[model samples]
Structures are given as C-alpha cells and as structure tokens.
Target chain A: MLYPRFKHFIEQKKMFSLGETLVVGASAGVDSMVLFDLLLKLSHVWKLKLVLVHVNYKLRGEHSDLDEMLVQEKANAASVPFFRFTHTEKSEGNFQEKARTFRRSKMEEVLDQQNAACIALAHHQNDQAETFLLRLLRGTGLKGLGGMKGSSLSKSGKKYIRPLLPFTREEIEAYAEEHKIAYRHDASNDDVSYKRNWIRHEVLQQLKQANPKIVNHLSHLSSQLREDEEALEYYVEAALQKVSISEDFGKCSLKREIYNSLPKAIRLRLSAAVFQKLFLESAILSADHREKIDHIALRKEGGKAQYFLPLNVLFTRDHEKIYFQKENVSE
Target chain B: MLYPRFKHFIEQKKMFSLGETLVVGASAGVDSMVLFDLLLKLSHVWKLKLVLVHVNYKLRGEHSDLDEMLVQEKANAASVPFFRFTHTEKSEGNFQEKARTFRRSKMEEVLDQQNAACIALAHHQNDQAETFLLRLLRGTGLKGLGGMKGSSLSKSGKKYIRPLLPFTREEIEAYAEEHKIAYRHDASNDDVSYKRNWIRHEVLQQLKQANPKIVNHLSHLSSQLREDEEALEYYVEAALQKVSISEDFGKCSLKREIYNSLPKAIRLRLSAAVFQKLFLESAILSADHREKIDHIALRKEGGKAQYFLPLNVLFTRDHEKIYFQKENVSE
Candidate 1:
C-alpha cells in the first residue's frame, strides 16, 4: 500500500525528473533502506540515476563500521555507486548540529561530484512528527510548526528531496520486511540527540495510545502548515509592496493605511521584514513585541512616534504613515 | 502578576465595552473561580455589570449540587447576581457534548433575559493546551490545531470571551491562592469525558517532562496559528475576488490562469469555497482530493473536464476557465 503511495507522492510532488541523478543519504536504518529499495524500483520507471551516500560518524565504534559495511555490500549487490565518508575527528559540542552540518556538506560534495539534480534523504512521517512535537514543546511559531518539506533547496542552492516523508515508520519497516531488504539497526541511538529521543520515545509513543494514526495526523498537519506558510510568505511580500511608500538607506516608511488594511498575520510578518530590511538588528521579535508593534501601527490615532522595537529600531506612526528607522548607524 | 495580565489581555483584545453587562460561566473549579474573582475586581474599574451563571449537570450527583452551592455562595458573598440551573433530567448519550450544549443554551437564555453583551468563559491556558494536544492526537487540520480563540462569536451571533486564556493552570491556582479566593474543586473529575482525561493525565503530563512550560508553547502556537488562519481566510477571499469570473446559482467559473497564479494554499481554499457555494455537497475535501483536483486544474492542457467532487459536483477545467456545477437538483 505504501509502495504505490510513495510513487504517487513522488509523481504528484514532481520530486524527480527522468534520468535525473540523485545523491541518496542512507544510515543503514530500515527507513533509509526502504527508501533505497523504493527508489531502486522506481529507477526503471523514472529513469532515475541513483547514488548512495553514507556517513560514518564513528561515534558508535564497531556499530558504525558494521552499518557502513552493510550499506556498501547492499550497494555493491545492486550495482549502485556508493560514497562513504568516515569521520575521524573527535566528537565535540553540539554533536547533532555539528554532525548534521558535516553530513550535509559531505552529501553536497557527493552531489556535486555526481552532478545530481538533488540529494534524497529518508525523513519519513515519524521523523517529521517528532520534529513538529519537539518544536511545539520547545516553543515555535507558524513556520516552526510547518515542519519539513517534501522538497527543499538549501541556502547554498543544492536541492534535497524527501520521497518517504509521508510514509510512517511502521510502513517503512513493513516495506523492508516484505522485500527482505538488508538494513542496520542504527545501534547509535544512544548517541542520538536527547530532544529527538525524548520526542520519539516519550511524547510520540504516549500520543500513539491516544490515536494509532497520530503520526499520520501530525504529518498531515505539517503538510498543511507548510502550504499555509507558503501562502503567508507570498502575501507578506505582496503586502510589503503595497505598503512601502519609500525606502532609503537604513530606513523605510510604509503607509499606515495600507499596512493597517492587511491581516494581523501578514502585518506582523511585514513589520518583521521591514525591520530586517532597514536595520537587521532585530533578529527575532517575540510574540509580545510583535503585538505591541502591531498595536501602535494599527491603532486608529492617539499613537505617534513613540514606539520602539529591539535594540535600536525606532517605530513612529502618525495618522498617515508608519516610519521605521535605524537609530544607530555604523560608519 | 496574572491579575494585571488578565486585565491587559481583555483590554488589548477589546473584549468588552465599558459598563457592558456580562454573563460569565463558572464551573466552581479553580480556573473559573479565579476568573470569577478577577472579574469581580475588574467590575469596578471597567464598570462591568457581572452575572455569574452555573449549571449543575447532576451527572456526579451530590458533587454537582455542591459545586452549584459553592458558586452561589461565592456570588452572594460578592453581592453579585448569580443564576443557578440544576439539571434534573436524565443525562444520557454523549454526556459531555449534551451537557455543553445545554449549558450554552441556558447561558444564552440568561444572556437574553439580562441583555448581556456576551458570555465570558474561564477557559484558561491549560484547557487550550489540552484541547490542542487532544486534537492533534485524534487527527486535525490547521484550523483544528489552532485551538480556541480569545474572543469568538458563535454561529447564532452571540459572543464569547476567554480572558484567562493566557494564564496557565498553575498561574490561575497561584492567583487564587494569592487573592484568598475560595473555590470548590468541582469533585466531578470522575465523570469527565474519557478522552479529555486521557489527554490531561497521559499526553500533556508526559510531555511536561520534556518541557515544563509546554502549555505556554502550545498556547503560543495556537495564537500564531489563529492569526495565520485569519490571514489565510482573508487571502482566500481576496484571491477569490480576483479569480472568480462568474458565480451563479449552483455554478461558478474561475479563471484557471488567475487561479494557478495564486499560492497553493489560497488556491486550495478557493476551490473548497467554490464547491461550497456551487454544490454544497462536498462539505469536506480530503488532502488527496484537494491534491488531485489541484493537479488537474493546474496541469497545462492535460486535463479538460471529468473531475468529480463528492456526491453531486462536477469539476471541469479548460485552457482558460475552471468550471464547477451542481449535478443534482431536488427541487
């Protein structure tokens, strides 16, 4: 069931093109193995050129090597090109973030070498749900709750695709068992980040008791929110265009009438963008800050040039226009 | 601390008018009782005429009556008008839902009798979090995940306000203790709905181990999503205005080019709204349906008519126009 659905998702999302080369990230885990097998089957239909890439952080000593060996053997059996990166550096602070950077850079290296259209990773439904829950727990806004996308481009311009994003872990395991795919157990769970483990083990499992399909629900929510965020970003840009009266160096004035006519969400996003464009000092605005700024901007009079945003951004709203300026300018 | 914040939330949201008569619902639980006390204090400053409404569902027998008595006693102590309703009728068939309906209608009845502006309910932050989590577990969309609003109008044109929405259960309890506000425990937890109990006891409590301030995060997400949903609704309407070529009875034609130019989120929403206006049969479109419909409508020259929505709506797309028509006419 999930096999056909995976193919359908790939087609519907237009994640791949005919004969497009892809750098596939594998951890020898069941999820990745299933993704590999699914893409292997899809290779003929989509004419996809597949290259498997694995990273051995060596944090798990023998376990990491064994995982790499299994993936290499499987790639050889399938006659697929394999790229293996072995990390010899000592593990330091922020293991997960650092490892993520190391792995993505290595994959991009392989991606460039192969001239692949994109890198494909095995981030399945469970992973997305866990990320969403983790973000919700730690506190997040609209964009955070949107979770991961099916296909995204990195800041450096390399594209990545997640064909297995909508498939649940159970479905991946089921697909793996049905095909007798060779995959490793990822015994390195002990070294995995605490927050991810807490979410996957404690939060998600307990929530599964409430609903057997909670992962699917969360995935659905993530997909919906992502679409929503896209729409919001578009509107915010449009609203910015409508409201901006003029933009000079280190300052932008927006027509208060136009800005006030926008929806609350778009108004807030526009304000944030205005600050980012003019000052760039207010890296993040808390909900309270946004509300206060919006209060003054949208208020129908009695508020003038007395509003202040973080650090050195001055907010002034008159009957006609709202002006934001950088107070401190470096020479 | 919560006292001032509570007042601030009400004023910031413009939840009430000066000297406006308000019907507040109290369950004798600490959350509502604290809300009752806060409003009692704010009554003078805001010149609010307060009427406390309590309903004893009698499902918990003696406990329910005790709750009513405690609320009535408190109302008498404050010299505030109190209206108590005792349900002697047999509680059957979805006790919680029925009790909620009965309670709201009774409260509204009193509202009309007193010419009150709106009903103020003591739905605190914990309730919002619990609702959000429970909805997530049971499966929900972006709107469902948005949870409750601070001030909302029911379909019947009556308004309801939740002033304590930003205050957590702990905050409410702490405020109650600080103010020496006497409130009953409601002693009816045993009769509460199973799903709510499961979520409150299992999911949220387990999640709290990961983040003690999870409630605040959930509340924050809800607030942000609510704002997002509002923005989405606004954009959908705006896009509809641009794309709609004609809307006649049981039919609507949209400019396919214009529709495709809009964001995916707004396009999907516009399609749903079109179906609602034209056929009214497709009450809810699943993600799959929306994706399929969108695929057909946006695909260049590949699809012409033959798209079917629920029961009796036909979706058709040509080179320039997307048309929808109701298939059945009962009259």
Candidate 2:
C-alpha cells in the first residue's frame, strides 16, 4: 500500500547519491525491520550501500542482546555493515532523555566512522501523534505541540531523516508480513509503566476504538496547526519588525494611544512577542497576565509597576510605556 | 469575587441610560441569576431596569416548570417584570438546534413587546471554551472556532450582548452565593450523553484539574489563534486580489511557477481559498482531500485533468493554469 510513498521518500532524499552509504537506526522492531529490508531490496536500483546500527542500553538483559543479534543477522544477509553498542547504564534516569542522548551519540559515532551522509530513523505517524499528545497534556504552546520534523541537522551537522514518518505502524507490519521479514519485539512497549506507554496502550487505543479514524483526524489537525503556526510566526516576525526594539530589552515602546488603537488581539500577541523576545524563551502566557499588563498600560495613575513572569523577567510599566527587564531590580 | 467584574460589565454596557427594562432569558441559572441580582443591586446607581425572562420547553415536565417558578419568584422579589414562555413543540429535534431557534424566537417576541434595548445572556468563559472545542472537533475553520463575539446583531436586528463571557462559572457561582441569590439546577448539564456535555463534563474538567488554569490557557490560545487567523486572512485577501479570476469557477489562476515557488504550507492555504470560494462552504477540505488536490496540481502531467472534490466541484488543470469549474466538464 505504501510502496509508492516509500519510493517518493527515497527520491526526495536523493538516496542513490549519498555516496552509496545509508545508516539505519535498528530498534529490532517491525517498522525498522521493514525499512531495513525495503532499503536492501532497492539497493541495486538506487545503487545504494547500507549500514545498520543498533544500540542496546542493557535495560532488558538477554532479550536486548537477542534483539541486537536479530538486526546483525539481517544486515549479514544483505551483506551490509552492522554496528552494535551496549550501554552499561539502565533505562532509569529520564528514560526518554537518556535513550535520546545515547542513540544520537552512537549514531554520530557510526556516521563519522563510515562517512555516512545521513542517519535514518524509524519514527512513524503514530509516534508523532504520541509526541503531540504528550506535549499537549503538559500545557505546551503551539511550537512544542507541533510534534517532530521529518528532517533536521544533528549536533555535529550530519543529517537526520525520518523517511517513514508519514506511514503508520500497521502499514509497516503489513509490509513486514508480506516480505516475511524477521524482527524482534521489545517487551518494554507493553510494560505501561512510562507515560508514553500508558498513552500509547491506553488513551490512544481507547480513542482509536471510539473513532477508528482518530489517528488520521489528529494527524490532519497537527499538520494544519503546523501550517497555522508557521503563518503565526510569519506575522510575529512582521509585528516585531514594526514594534520591536533591541534584543537586550526586546521592548516595543509604542504610544499608549496608538497601541490601544490596534485590535485587542494584536495588542495581546504583541505583548507576548515582547515577553518571549526579552526572556529568550516561549512559555504559555495566561489571560490574567495579559489583562494585568493591559491594565497597567492603561492605568490612569500609572507610576512604576512590575509584574513577574515565568522565567524571572519583570514587566514594568511607567506612565504609558511597558518594558521587560530582569526581575532582580526594583524600578 | 465577581462583583467587581459585574460592576465593570454594567459600566461597560452603559446601563445607566436604559431604565426599567427586563433581563430576559433568566433560567435561574448561575449566569442569568447572577446577572439578575447584579442589575437589581446596580438599579440605584444606574437607575436600571430589571426583569426575568424564562422559557419552559416542557421537556422535563415538573422540573422545567420548577425552573420557571424559581426565576419568577426571584424576579418578583426584585420587583421586576417576569415573563414566562411555554413551548408547544417541546423541541423534540436536536436539543441544541431547537433550543437555539426557540430561545431566539422568544427573545425576539419579548424584545418587541417590551421595547427592550438589549437582551443580555449569561454565557461565560466555560461556554466559550466548550464552543471552541466543539468547533474544533467538527473540523470548523478559523472563524467558527473564534468562539462567541461580545456583542452581535440578532437575526431580528436586536442587540445581543454577553456580559459574563470573560468570567468563569465559578466566579458567577461565588457571586451568587455571596449575595445570597437563589438559582435553579439544570440536570442536562450532567447527562454526558451529548457530545458537548461529554467535552464539558469529562475533557474540560480533566484539563482544568490537571492545569488548574485551563480556562485562562484556552482563552489565551483562542485570542492568539484569532490574531494569527486575522493576519492570515489579510494575506489570503492580498493573494486573492492577485490570483482570483471569478467566484463561479472558484477560478484562481496563479502563475504556476510562482505558486510552486512559495512555501508548501502557503500553497496549501491558497489552494484551500480557491476551494472555499468555489464550494461556498467551510470545513469541506480534509487533509487527504487537500493532498490529492495538491498532488494533481504538482503532478508531472502536462495536459488537462479533472479532480473531483467532496463538495461536487471539479478542479481542472491545463499545464500551468488551474480551474475550479463545475463537475460536468470534459477537461
């Protein structure tokens, strides 16, 4: 079903010209296995070379080693380079953070040794949806809830690409089954101890059952939101051009009469933009915070007044002007 | 807690000029009851008019009549006009659809006979959130998800104002309790059978508990989205000026090379505008539908081809020129 999509992904990546070297992050999962085999089959047509990298964090003992062996065997059959690393640290301290750090380091090491152009990962649509939901549950702003990008530059300037991100897990499983690809299953996915596991197994499943098309609906929502968010960033840039001052203050001082003349919504966004620029971070600003700032700016007897923000930035209003400065000092 | 807010609302409404008028649509609910007593107390300062309008759809039999009596006694004690309505139809259709139609008709009748300048309703922040969520779930585009406006002209050209929309239900309940005002309970709110009720009782409640500031967060999101949406509409209007040919064909013939040179997200939105203009409807385009249309436009085909939309409009392309004409066509 997704062969055309996979072909499109390969074409988009210019995979054939990547020095015949392809680095795949193998998790011993069905999705990764399917991707590994598909790349292997397309190797001749695309004039490709394959490198498989597997990282076992020693969290699941013998099962982890067995999973690594399965990936090594698959690479051996395809006559490709296989690399495996076993970490002594367990998946205990911030499982996601630790795993991410370890995986990136290992991928970078393999890429450097092999002189690979890009590192490929097996993140799919379901994972993206999980990420979006996770961020939303934590009261994230729009950018945070945009899930993951399909391509980005790694810390060492190497390319990281997710070619399978647009496809679903079921599609991958179907492909694997059709091709008779051998893959190992991770038991941790069913443990349900982690928050992501809980959401993946419980909340998402329930939502899927309630509406079979929930994943598609949510993915569509996220894509639309991403577009809308890009448009917002464009406007914020425009608003900053008109009203922003300097990076240090990040303060846009406008005539009180002029600021008030703009729409209430723009006034709020302009305030948010100023706050974000001054703090050098984006956090959710409450309606109360917005109203307080509005009140301060519009105060009849406006002396110097200060309001505290999340990142210890003080928003100060003196007469008709508002400025964001560090929180330690009193005006 | 909300007394100051109520005071601000009355002053904002310029209620001093309107004397001895009825506060219609008083179901003895928290919103209406709070508004009723606020108007009664402010009668001295504003030389105000206060009356209660109650409509009994008779769906709940004795419970519905009891709600009406509660409002009548409340208005009687305040020594204001008490108007009661009984619906013969009982609104057996979609509860929301019927309630809205019947409520407005009743409001129109009272406003006409009593010469009331405005009909005040007690919709508050929670209602706005529910409205936004509903619009989101149903795939409404930007404008529908903007929640309710502060003031609007009713179908009959009467002024409709919502004074409490910025305040939460808790604030109104607190004000009612502090002022010793009696209110009726509506059991339908807890039904959980209706989609809106499910969202209100389950999803919103959970969100509120988890964040402890969900309303403010949602309101901020809404305001920000509204600003971004307005800015996008401005851009769309500008793009339309350059590209749009006619509404009949939804005919927007952009220079293909230039359109393709624009960002993919903008291209999608511009395409949506063409679809919207031709369809003359909102919420018709899904992500898949959009992708199909985009694929056709971006395809390698050099000749004319037809793409059918769900709304029965056919998009035809001839090399660099795109046409959104009627479905019956030999492209």
Candidate 3:
C-alpha cells in the first residue's frame, strides 16, 4: 500500500522527475526500507527507473552485511537494479561524519555510472530535528540551525533529495507496520557513545515532556530559518557581485566601504564565500571566524589590520579594501 | 564599581547619550535591583539624570507595594528622581501581557513628564532564553525567535533600552550579593501557571543537562537570528517600496508581479506589513498565514484568491494586484 501522505508530499515538492533514473540510499533500516518500498510502488505509475544503492560500512560486522542482503533481495523482488558499495576506510575524528562523507562520495559514483537524475535519501523530520539540536548545542549560526535542505545540488552537480523529510519517525514507523514491510533494527542506535544518539535518548525526551509536538515545532523552526537564510543569501550574492573588485586563485579583494554598508549577516556570508573561493573545497569556517573577519572589515579607525583564519588564510583590511590570500603567500 | 563589560557594550552599541534624562524600570527583583545599583554608580561618570519608575501591579497584595517602597527608598538614597504608579485595574486575559502593556504605558507617561530620552528595562540573558523557548513552542517565525532588541523605538516614538540584556540571571544575582543590595524575590516567578515560568523551570533545566551553556547558546542563537532578520527586513522594506502601487488609511494595493519576484521571507514580511497597516495596532499575522498567502500569490495558474487573515482583514490577489482591507469593507 502506498502511504498517501508521502505520495502527496513527493508530488507536491516535485522531489523527482517522472521518468528519470534515480538512486535510493537504502540501509534496510525502517526509514530507508519504507522509502524504497514507496518508490517501487510509485515507480510503476510515474515511469521511474529505480535503483537501490546500499553501503555496507562493515563496521557492524554481520549486521551490516545482513542490511545489504535484505535491500538487494527487496530490489530484486521489485525488479529494480541493486548496487552495493563496501566501506573499508578507517574513520578518523568524528566517525559518523567520516562515514557519511564516504557514503555520499560512493553514491555519487553510482549516480554517475547509472546516469541517474538524482539520489534519494531517507532523512525524515526527526532526523532534521536531531540535526537542528546537534547544531544548536555546537554553537551554530542561522544556516546551521536551518539543518538539511530538501533538495540540494552536490559539488559535482548531482541533485540529492530528501522526500521523507516532512514526515516524523512515528508516522514512518506506522506506515511500515501498516504496509507489513520487513526492516532491520540497528542496535547501535541506542549506544549513547554517538553524540546524536545521546541527544536523541537524553535531550529530546526531556524536551518532549515540555511540548509533545517538540519535533514538529523544531522542524518548523528549521523551515523558517531556511527561508530566511535563502533570502539573505540572495541579497548577499547581489551585493558581492557589486562589491567584489577582483578575484583569482587563492586571492580576492573587495571594496571596504561598499561591504560595510551591507547587513552584518550578509557581510559575514560574503566573507565566507570569499574564504571558500580561496580555501580548500571541503573547508568550513565557523561563525565566530566569519564574525571576526567582518569586524576587521568594518572597523572605523582601521589603518592596516591582519588576522589568520582557522583555514590558514591571511585576512588583511586597510582603509581602501579588504584582501584574502594564502597565509604563507607574500604580496 | 561599574560593570566593565556593560560599559564597553554601551560604548560599542551606542545605547545611550551622555547627560540625558533616563528612566529605569526597577521592579526590586534581583535583576532590576542590580541594574539599578549599576546605573546609580555609572550615572555620575556618564552625567545621566536618572529616574526610578516602579509599577505596583497590586496583584500580590502587600508584596507589590513592598516592591514599590524598596525601589523608591533606593532612589531616595541615591538622590535620583523617583516615580511610582499603582496598577489597580484588574487584568482580563493573559495577566502577564496585560500588566506588561500597562507598565509600558505608565513608563512612557513618566518619561514624558520627566522629558527623559529613553526608559531602561532589566531583561537579562536568561529571560531572553526563556522567551526564545516560549515563542518556539508557540510557533513563531524569525522575528519572534530573534528575541528582544537592546534598543527599540515604541510606536509613540519613545525609546526603550535593555542594558542588562547581555548578562545572565546568575551574574546579576552575584553582582547584587557582592554589592550588598537588598532585593525582594517575587513569588510569582515560581508559579508554573505562567508559560514562561513553566519553560524556565521545566524546558530550560532539561536543556541545561545536555549542555550547561544552554542559556548562552540560546541567546547567541537569538543574536544570529536577530542579525539575519534585520538584514531581511532591509531588503523587504526596499521591496515593499517598489511593489506597493497605492496606499490609503486602511488599505494597500501592491503590484502582483513585483511581489511574486521577492524571496519567501521578504514576501511574508511584506504581507504582514500590509496586514498591520490595515488592521489593529497590536495585530500580528503568524508565519503560517503569511506563507499561505505567499503560496496563493505564487500559484502558476492564478485567477483570483482571497484569504481572511487572523486580524479580520481580507487579503485579495487578482491578476494585476494584491489588496488588503478590512473584512467588511466594500471594494
């Protein structure tokens, strides 16, 4: 049985093309399994060429292999293509982030090989809320609090979609049960060592006591912030086009007076954009760093101010202009 | 001794002018008393003519009067002008909101009588965090989550300032204890009947367990939202000026094509501004309402759409223009 709400959501959001090849990031968990089942049902009507893509991280031993096997069996039953990628890279620093990045890269490779239109991920409303809470606790700014986008283009120009984002975990679970879909439960979800798991078990439950609809409220907040962030980004892009004097590899300069006239939010974003243009592709600048650079740009009594950003970029501000360059590079 | 951080904050933010008459709303609570003491100490250095204004809501019997008496006594000892207003009128609904409105009106009256430049209120960081949570649970947009402004001009052109907004409740209490300042604790603060108190005791405490710096994190989030909001408002104001075709006392007609081209956040704000221009002074349209109107405006095949907003105003969109007028008003 097709979940009417999820079907309506996908139709309304135009999450995928009617007859395009698409990749599903399936993990045999309730979230991804439900998504896979729904897409298979919809594919017949929408003329979608469906492909199930699973990543056996091999971190959970036999459990990960079982997850891959289940997804492959379902894909075969539905008469759809199935692809499995084995993750063998040892995670350093944050395990979840590393694993997620690796999964994304592997999925993009499959997307290219299949000539797929986009990849669908099963990040639901609860996942969005968890991301919001995690970012909030980490001292994030507006963009971070906005959480995941429903559809975003990757660096290599591949579109990624989260069709299940509007539905809560409870709703998805109910859909799975009503449809009698079999899914594997990952026990690691309860292991509190994962920061997200800690927040899910300890923090969200406490918040739910105050407001039963806490998850919905948080997701709503994220939507609001996302809208605002997009609006600001539009203006920032316009401002940057006018204020930026010159640009090159690893170096750029912007007019000081014109930049100062923009809003603080726009100024910070403009600085980040420049930093991204200069620094490595995967580098992310903290809000505090962006703010420090903004202050350097806007100071009234500036003679010649200089600061080193976290990404090892030298930011210099003078009376006429602000410049960014590689830290060790000479003028 | 004065608070160095506050002094620097004032200098940086340009919160007040030198040698001006200012009114401080002293409630005799630890937050306000500490503010009172700090202001009294800083007045001589800044050459400020200070007035202490106390509102006795008379809701708590003798406790209300005692609060007034203590504040007045402090004003007398400091040799600063003092004014007291007795709020005897019974509240109708939402007593806190009613009392707050009444107190604000009375303070403006005092300011007019004294020819003061602005009135100061001691709304600290924790109060800000509580407000963010309260508004979040109640479903607010970016503006509400931004929390209170450090300085805002009232509708009547009176300025209200919050100098203690950067400090937390504990910080204020510590300052009060260090200065040997006597302050009365309002028993009403412990009343869970009030939603703000419920959140403070229940929600915030739960959040604190996950992250001890929850209050600071929330306030920081507010600051970020506030900056983003201000930037969006700037663009919205500019957009409204260009889009508005005609305006009357209680009606506004805006160009549909131009309005549709704006960002969603700006579009929603422009709609609310039009609603405010046509409806009651205190009327506020929710983000959901604004979003619905935006959807109606942006529909690809539009004929004619009408929505009855919360403020009893009719929002009409035709092929050429959008109209806002009182519900019963004939076109």
Candidate 4:
C-alpha cells in the first residue's frame, strides 16, 4: 500500500521519468537507505537507471568510512552503479553547510559525467518540518517558510526529486525495519553547530505536545505556503511591470501611485523586488525596514524623503518618482 | 521614553485622530488597565473623549464583580465616563469564545451609541505571536498565518485599534509597574480549554530557547505575511476574474486553460474562493484535495474527471469549462 501510494504521489507530482538515470544521494542513514531500497524495487517496474552516490565527510573517522562501505556494499550487492566522494578538506566553520555544498557539486558533476537526468534525495516530512521551524525561528518570509518541494529545478537548471518527501521519518524507519534494510546512524552529532539536528531532535519534539500531528501539520502548511509563494511570485512579477518605472545598474525607480494603488502585500513585495533589483545579493530586510519603506512611500513626497537600507541602498522619493539607489555600487 | 515611542507609533500608524470619541475595552487585566491609563494620558494632549467599557462574565464568582468594580473605580477617579456590561446569561460550552463575541458586540454597541470612532483593545505583540503560532500549528495557509492587524474595520465597517500591539507583555508590565498602575490577574485558567493561554505560557516559553525573540519574530512574520496575503488576494481576485468563467445560483464554472496556466498557489486560492461563493461557509480543503484538483484540471478533460469536495461541492472539468457545483444546495 505504501509503495503504491509513494509511486502514485511521484506520478501525480510528475517528479521523474521512467528509465532515466537518477543520481541517488544516499548518506547511509535510514531515510536514504530506505529510499535506495524503494528505488531498487521500483527499478524492476519503471526500469529507472539507478546511480547511487555517497559522500563520506570522514568526520566520524572509522564510522564514516564504514558508512561509505555500507552504501557501496549495498550497491554492489544490488548490481547497481555507484560513485563515492570523500571530503578530505580540513573541517572548518559550518562543516555541515560546506559539506552540503561540496556534496551537491560532486553529485552534479557525476550527473554531468554520466549524463544522468536528476539527483534524487532522501529528505522527508520531518526534514521539511525541521526546515520550516528553523526558518520560522530564524525569521523568514513566505519563501523561506514555504520549505522544500517534492521536486524542483536548481539554479543551474539541473533537476532534483525527493520521492520520500510525502512520508514521515517514522514511516521510513518502519519500512526500513519491515524490509530489514541495513543502515547507519550518525552517533553523537554536535547539537550546537548542527542546528537542524537540534531542531529535529529538540524543537519539533517539544512542538508535538502543542499538536500531536505537528510534523504533518507543518508539512501541509509548508506545501500550502509553497503554492502561495509561487502564486505570489507571479503577482510580484506582474506588479513589477506596473510599479517599477525604470531600473539601472544601481538604481530602480517606481511610481508611487501605482505602488500605493496596489494592496499592501504587493506594495511591500514591489519594494522588496525593487531592492533586489538594485542590489542582487543584499542583506536581510527586517520587518522594521519594510515598515519604514511603507511609511516613506506615502508620506508627503519630496527630496527630504530619504532612507538608507542596510546595504547602503538609499531610498529617496520626489514629485515624480520613488528611487532606490545603491550608494557604493562599485563594491 | 516608552510613552513617547508609544505615542509616536500611534501617530505614525494613524491609529487615532485628535478629540474623537474612543471606546476602550477594559477587562481589569494588566493589558486593558495599562491601555486605559495610556488613553487617559493621551486625552489631555489631544482633548479626546474616552469611554471605558468593561464586561464581567460572572464566571469567577465575586472576583468577576471585583474586576468590574475596579475598572469603574479607576474610570471614576480619572473622571472618564464608563459603561459596564454584566454577562447575566448562564455559563455554557465554549465560554471564552462566546464571552468574546458577547463582549465585542456590547463594546461595538457602545461605539455606535456614542458615535465613537473606534473600539480600542489592548492586544499586543504576544497576542499576535500566539495567534500566528496557533494558526501555523493548526495547518493554515498564508491568510491564517497573517494573524491580526493593529487596526482594522469590522464587517459593519466599525474601526478597532490595537495601540499597544508594538510592545510585548514584559514591556507593558514594566510600564504598568513604573506608573504604579493596578491591574487584575486571572487567578486560575484551564490550560486545556484556554488554548491561547497554553500556547502563551508553555509553547512560547519552549520556543524561546530556540530564539529569545520568538514573539517579535512571529509578530514580524505575521505582519510581513499580512502584506503577502493582501498581495496574493489581489492576484487571486484578478485571476478569479479571468479563470472563473461564470457563476450561477449554486455553481461556478472555470476555464481549464486559464486555471492551468496560473501558478499552483493561485489555483488553490481560486478553488477556495469558488468554494466560498458556492457554499458561503465550507469545510477546509486540504492540501491533498488541492493536489487532486490540480491533477484533474490539467489531466484529460472529460465528464469522468470529477472530484467532490467537503460539503458536497462537485468539481468537474471538460475541454473548455471546469465546473464547481454545490451538490446539496437545498440543504
């Protein structure tokens, strides 16, 4: 029943193509092991070309190598193609994040080398919930709160899919147990630095008392918000055409009448879009910053209306136009 | 300094006008008491008319009567006119919610009688945070996550203001203590029944270890989402016009081509709005339900492609028009 439902969800979401080469990102964890097993089972039906990829960061010394060996052994036993990458780089600040970047680049490289279609990950509902709670606690907008998608195209135009996304971690664990799938668990991770681990083990557990189905609830909210974000992006794009009169290397100008005429949400989003246009990668715009922009946009417009954002982006309004200009664009 | 900042916030937000009649909802709690004191001080500067209104549900025995007496006594000491409403009705199921409805209607009645500009409540950042968290935990879309506004108009177009929304409970308590303001405390509250109280006292406390500024973050996120929701609503309204082909007595027909062309978020929102139009008030459409609709809309177009939502709303699609009809309209 679970297998059928999982396949159905993947088919309904149009996550992947049958018989296409898929780079499976397995970490020797229960989720990835279960994911690998499911895909192996699925291969008989859909004939999906499975290429198992693992990156051993070697953080846990012997345990890490054993983790890599387990994945390799599974791949060898199943008669599947496998690729392994070792992160020999000296462990430094933000080991998890840096390792993730290294791992993804390596996986994508394999995809390029093997002409594989997309990378398949083992991220599930708990991961989605943890990510949303982390983003929420860290203070993010709709885009961040929207959490992960089951299938998405990356910035490099490469595709990735998470077939296990619709299921919870408990379900995956149950499946792993039922199928007798061997997997390794990372023991004694640094809870302080591994913020997501802390959230998964601590925060979400505590939140469950508030609502027993916190995981599923967060997952549902995130997917709903994801759709919301996609829709909002469309609206933002449409409003950008009307509200923004002109843009340059360091400056974006807008028509206050058009901006104010729109709803408050669009107005704020337009301001954000204009800000993003001026400085491609800017600092965080706090809610207070948005409030200030909302204030000055409508207040008696003149040259006196000038506010500086965190990135030295100067917002100035006049009789004709409201402008956001980067003061030090050369940097 | 707090007073000045508070006044500035009120003025900047355009929360109130000078010398207008304002009905203050006083519950004798610290929040309402502090609010009453603030408005009283403001009246001297702006020559405003302050009418204090308190509702006693009479559930807490003589303590409830004492709460009323204290509010009336403070109003008398300040020489401000007051109105007190006693909940003479028997206490029944969902006492808090029913009490709130009864209280608000009575307050609004006062506003109508005195031609008051707005009913001022003492909802602060904490209230905003709780509402957002509750909604988020309960699995809500962006609209629910937007939470409450600082100032808004009711269905009847009567204005209500939350002047202290920018401040936290700690700040309010500090101000109350500094000013030697006396306030009542609800001695015993049922943590099980009072969901917000449980969230306020327990859930929020647990979340603070993850982030100390959780309340403020939730408030900021809600405000940001408020803008996002408003913007999405505008887009939904726009898309609603283009996609929804026509509406009849108990049915709405949409264009499959148009609905499929729009982003996933708008399609879901459009579906909710259409459902609202047909049934007036309907049960929730889950994310799964939305996925099904999204599937049917773009899938093979025929009479066979039909989905029934909660409350007997039938969704069917053909080549040109997709229809949503209330199956049990007579009920």
Per-residue CA lDDT of candidate 3, range B302-325, in tens?
A: 689899887567788888788777
Q: Per-model C-alpha lDDT, please? A: 0.83, 0.71, 0.83, 0.83
Better of 1 and 3 by DockQ: 1
lDDT of the structure predicted as candidate 3: 0.83
Query: For model 2, what is the error of residue B23's alpha carbon versus the real structure, in angstroms, after optimal superposition?
Result: 4.4
Q: How many angstroms is residue B42 displaced in model 1 relative to the true structure, after the best TM-score fit?
A: 2.3
lDDT of 1 by residue, B59-135 (tens): 67777888888999988988889998877667558767778888999999999999999999999788888888777
Using DockQ as the measure, which candidate wins?
Answer: 1
Clashing pairs in 2: B20-B49, B21-B49
Candidate numbers sorted by TM-score from highest down? 1, 4, 3, 2
Candidate 4 runs further than 4 Å off: A189-194, A243-250, A283-286, A300-304, A309-313, A326-331, B189-193, B243-250, B282-286, B300-304, B310-313, B326-331
Give lDDT tens digits, candidate 2, residues B1-331.
5767777865654433546554457876778888777666667676767656888878778988888889888877778788887776743457768777888888878877887777888888788777766665565445554656556676568887777767887888888788888887888888987777877777677555446777655654554566556656766666666675765544556666666554456667777887776567674576567767677778775677778776567777778876666565566
Model 1 Cα shift for residue B282 (angstroms) = 8.2
**Residue A177 alpha-carbon offset, candidate 2, angstroms:** 4.9
How well docked is model 1, in DockQ terms? 0.83
lDDT of 4 by residue, A1-331 (tens): 5688789878877887888888999999999999999988888899888999999888889999999999999999998889999888986697768998999998999999889989999999988898898898888888898878888988888899999988999999999899999999888643645678788877777678778889988987887788788877777788777644444556777787776677777677778877776577555566577778878887763555888887888888776567788786574
- Cα displacement (angstroms), candidate 2, residue B293, comes to 4.7
Worst 10 residues of 3 chain B by lDDT: B242-251
**By DockQ thresholds, what CAPRI class is model 2?**
acceptable
